[model samples]
Target: MLSASEASIEAELKTKGLNAPRLTPADIDAAIVGEDFHVFPGTTMTVCALKLRNGFVVIGESAAASPENFDASIGRRIARDNARNRIWELEGYRLRSLLAANA
Candidate 1:
């Protein structure tokens, strides 16, 4: 399910007549075959590596200003989000290329 903001954007898109193929959440999940995360030793830095189905890897990082203020959960979440953001662009490009080819 899309978040409220996303839903709103989707609705607006429909109103403006943008019915072209889009990169949905399911597409992102389907593209990702494996995921791994790491938190650096003695630091608040976290990194997430997402492996796509085509063997490409996308990496994302998160870091807290002070180790004392860092939470592993938050760091991992943020890092994963950053990684996922990259997938959107990659997948979008793939979709566009396929569309152009078929045009």
Candidate 2:
């Protein structure tokens, strides 16, 4: 069952006509900047790179920090969300073009 947040996200994607291809951890290359508890006191930054089947590459970066410690996954999730938002923006243009054609 999809959680409320998941359902909402799905609906938003569908409404925007943004369909993202499946991406696995292996398909994404991640780079972490600022060592946890070393370089950055309590923050971690991650940059994720994904190569699309269309021969285009998209990169996203995010920084996250917790009160007690730094969570690497948090940064990764933020970066992934950033990349998805970029994809949505690109897809929006395509949707506009399609609408213009059909009109």
Candidate 3:
């Protein structure tokens, strides 16, 4: 797996991504500046917060109906993935807006 800051990855992404006329994984990845996670006390609830470059925050949640099924690692990953999915929609809209403005 390539780290996000690698020049080769960024170069390739910029070259191919700009002309695609749609949101790309690189685009979404680029927008994320920070991530935070939390679990509610005495509950099987997990929360993930993604901080974007523009200072906007998106949140995602995961909960287990039963304590027996709750796993810390799994819950955190699920919550983070849920938050990551929202970034796609937000980035898609941003891409669309940019496209519209340039048209």
Which predicted model would earn the best TM-score?
A: 1
Q: What does candidate 3's lDDT look like per residue over 25-71, in tens digits? A: 66777888999999999999999999999999999899999999999
| Ten contiguous residues minimizing lDDT sum, candidate 3 | 1-10
Q: Per-residue CA lDDT of candidate 2, range 1-101, in tens?
A: 23466568667877998865532222232212222212244447677665555556566777655545556676676676666556555556665777789
Q: List the residue pairs that clash in candidate 3.
A: none
Which candidate ranks first by lDDT, i.e. highest?
Answer: 1
lDDT of 3 at 96: 88
Model 2's TM-score against the true structure:
0.54
The residue-level lDDT of candidate 2 at 32 comes to 21
Q: What TM-score does each of the candidates earn?
A: 0.84, 0.54, 0.78
Which residue pairs show collisions in model 1? none
Model 1 poorest 10 in a row by lDDT:
1-10
lDDT for residue 72 in candidate 2, whole number 0-100: 69
